[model samples]
Target: MVIKEITYGGLSREHLFDRLKGYPIFLNEFAEMLLFSPHFCPSPQQQSLSVAEITVGGLGLQQGGTLEEIRKQARLLGLVECPLEAAFYSRFYFTDQEEVSKKVVNQNPPGALVIYSKPLLADRNFPRGLYLRKIKGDLWLRGYRCSDDYVWSPLDAFLFQVNASSRTLE
Candidate 1:
């Protein structure tokens, strides 16, 4: 599906990161929009748009109230919670045990992950962009997105899952 381009406009990197630190979905949506819609701007009348997203972290997939944990973490670091205006709901997935800790050793990190890597355009920087809960069953990445927001192929998802698993092994 066609998406819209992200208009960072006057937003600075620090501002973006600061906004994203507490709300990972903002970054996820931003990336998705940038990738899909390099130049997408709907008419002002197009108010309802579906957005799909995938967030992988300690928690596995998307779950409700996950943002509170993210917000808490950001609060600890003196950040603010992201507003609903920044994003919308889509889909969520929780990683299985095999994905959390791998038996094989690789260049990936060790933990649950949901990552995707593309060319210089979009790449999943696992373990780095990822944040560990430091505890189990606490939900890794606390975010969600709508289905229309993402238009991923099976190969894309598989490759990302594989890479994410590698990170857990590390």
Candidate 2:
């Protein structure tokens, strides 16, 4: 398979860290900046026209709703409740342990993250964007694409690397 390298539009690895100034930074407001700022030339370069994506946070929609839990509570009270009422509460469930719930935004202060990084996978489905989540007091970064539900990779993977002084192509 022939894959092309993807570059993040702004900042080097070290510089990105500098911008963060450390974890606990609030990044929920810059979703759009992280998405198109650098731009990715469609993973497969031939998937479809374009994919639609909603910026990560902002309304609490990202965290799903409390209807299911509330429904159960109402049902226990023997009160008549509409089944459809809880539909809006649908939460994002992950198929793998690696996936983080949108609830992270709610649980974390300032409510959301705006993180960016290099591409670890150039597969057609891999999205070229940023992700931020706070879990157990430690902040974690993720690279999640639109249309699909999965973190392409972790930001930590790029933390350490040596620069090559020259290319070996003939």
For model 1, residues 1-170, the per-residue Cα lDDT tens digits are 11222222233334444544554333344344432343323232223322212232222323322333433332333233211222211112222323344332332234433222112222343111222211243333322232222322221111112121122223
Over 4 Å off, model 1: 1-12, 23-105, 121-170
Candidate 2 weakest lDDT stretch, 10 residues: 85-94
lDDT of 2 by residue, 1-170 (tens): 01112232234434443444453333333332332334422231211111111122211234332323322322333222211101101101111113344453222223223222244345545444444445554444434443324321212211111112212111
Candidate 2 to truth, TM: 0.24
Q: Candidate 2, which segments miss by more than 4 Å at Cα?
A: 1-11, 17-123, 148-170
Question: Which pairs of residues clash in candidate 2, taking residues 3 or more apart in a chain or in different chains?
Answer: none
How far residue 70's Cα lies from its native spot in candidate 1, in Å, is 31
Please give the clash total of every predicted structure, in order: 23, 0
Per-model TM values vs. the true structure: 0.23, 0.24
Cand. 1 TM to true fold: 0.23
